[model samples]
Target: MNDKTQDIAIVGGGLAGASLALLLSHHLPQLKITLIESFPLFNSDNEKSLPSYDDRSSALSLGSCRILQTLTIWSQLKPYLTAIEKVHVSDRGHPAGTLLDYRELDDISDEEALGYVVENRHLGQVLLSALAQQSNIDTISPATVAEVTPQADEAQLVIRQGDKQQRLAANLIVIADGAHSSLREKLGIAVEKSDYGQVAVIANITSSGYHDGVAYERFTDSGPMALLPLGDFNDEHRSALVWTVDSDREADVVAMSDEAFLQTIQQRFGNRLGFFTRVGKRHIYPLALYKAKEQIRRHIVLMGNAAHAMHPVAGQGFNLALRDCSALVDTLCDATVRGQSPGELDVLNHYLSRQDLDQEKTIGTSHLLTLLFSTAETLPAFARNTGLFGLNFLPGIKAWFARQAMGVAGNRSQIAQPASSTAAEKRIK
Candidate 1:
């Protein structure tokens, strides 16, 4: 490969794109990288121009934390990391309620938390900060896409960064934009979208009681609500809330205030997490499941939310996206080692084949669980709660569920690296 031609184009400056740039740079320092963002540049402190991640936060699995730590970016956002030592789940008003302590799982260690919660801003900033350390990465913003015409060997991208536009060619183009990615649609890519008729009302609340690193998820007839702890932010006990409400309830949630919202919050949320004291700003997003028809198309590939955007009930979007990041990076890095064109069909499909099982299992399971729980009828509720309560009596079954949640139940060989930091331990397949 010519040094000048060994460049990859990343179309998105979100967490997924920035992480991909850092990983590629870490593995192949000689390759050139061009990262583009449609949003204009601005300081993080400019509230007037800032976009709100709202009360929204992401829970990163241990596997995800491992990836970020390997890139040396975890320390940048450590202050914001809320380790989830245990997850308490229950069905309000039902006979059976379930709370899962990580200690029950023999596979998971006692010291390691189940996951870590970090706001999106923290993730983006940390990723961008890590990108600055890479000499080969060229980050650009306010970029307009002129064209994305796929060629036999490479996909040509004409990106207008500012006044001057450059005709850049990349061996591979990775798309990490959200569910409604215009670029993916423009490229004639097909996608499967399912509307759940649900809205996720999110907010951050200051709780009077300490969470003690416990993340709570309760499912009521309305929908699934998650109370994720925020690690002692500003000397206050905080937990991010994501409540999935039906279309009819969305209007009321949007109009609620700190005082009025607390009333409803207390109704479902028992005294377990202490009093609901104060609430920060709130935001809402419609829930939907989207999966791209194909993982790879010629020289173009979609990762992150662009590939599959699931309902937040499972908190698997970013985790699944990170798996994509690792798989793609490994594939390209291994191709480089073998002196083969990374964008070749054989090479790209090899990566896709390794990821297909995991991709289908997570997305399908997400949709399936959503359908099963959202049932409003009493009979369905009885059956589901029976299962939840039954697991409490049987420690064996609880361990199985715990392992599944930890991403160790299935054959995760595609995303699992050997227990070593040496580059040679990384798997090509």
Candidate 2:
């Protein structure tokens, strides 16, 4: 077996792993990084070959957009994005509803939308393309990590590619294999999980009326549903639909005829965007919240879905992960200046310390929203509707809620700052 040494090794090449690799390469060009994946990487032509780059869409919060913008590839992703100008939230049977407009935000200008939505495939393409252009990053795909052994100084990885094997040593190892992480299990890391007893049915839909860049979040007795605006395809006014339902209804919902599915969703979602005209392919996945017991070890770090997976009722999952990435980058950059090893426990702990509060707040809010909106209990129902109604009258509270949704409510990371203000940008040139 051949042996190699690198400054860092990433276990997964999915969205989180790819984004981390790019951030590291951009900010710390002197460090040698290796990215490992079980699936083939850079096969953009065959979208099905890559599981992460599916037909689903991701809502990029304003803060997440700023993070991507700092990477200098947002322009490449711009054409594929659909801006969300307003957010209309309401309860199915209640007369109370609130409209969150982008113009109402104090920090955001009229030229900027509250957030943007882009197809996952397009996002994957841009990230991969940027990774290909980095000179300091090495990608090893169509392979897997069979074992990881941490030593006194660094972590060793046993890699497998078909019949051949290789040994790799790195100062730091980032695990981003997904929510169901096999690598995390091998390391004896435990996770706390809460099953919501629900599943989300996702599909792209067309409506008779244009969406006008308005995203809708409507809560029903059954569950919460969201319709996020999408860029038109083939001249059809389109939106992405995420409808949560009881787990027992999964098979029936996926098996429904297109017309039946459209009618059912129309009845639940109302006529905000006119009648539901077309329903595309449907996909279903069970809903659960999972958080790793430990995010950091002596020479390891768990990232993205591997560390925390929350309910999507509030659309905060990916945005939170991106913020974690930004914080990690900042911490590592500081370590390099101090002439410290990235694998030091103190360094890893500092990274976690910076993110612990954000993670706790984001995860707690998502769980609360899922529970508060997924039931018809008299007390909870009245409280939620009253809160929604009050948002219309309370500008301070409503703005705070909007900032939370935009992923900019709390302290912003320095790495997510604009190119001119970020100290890391100086290293790039």
- After superposing candidate 1 on the true structure, give the runs of residues whose Cα lies further than 4 Å from its correct spot: 1-6, 45-55, 162-164, 413-415, 418-429
* Deviation from native of the Cα of residue 353 in model 2, angstroms: 0.4
RMSD of each candidate? 4.0, 3.6
lDDT of each: 0.76, 0.88
Candidate 1: residue pairs that collide: none
Judged by lDDT, which candidate is best? 2
lDDT of 1 by residue, 373-393 (tens): 786688778877888888889
Candidate 1 accuracy as lDDT: 0.76
Instruction: Report the poorest 10 consecutive residues by lDDT, candidate 1.
Output: 420-429
For model 1, what is the alpha-carbon lDDT of residue 200?
A: 89
Candidate 1 TM-score, true structure as reference? 0.91
Q: Compose the digit string of candidate 2's lDDT tens values, residues 38-136.
A: 988877466445666787788998778888887878889999999998999999999999998876664465446788999988898898889888999
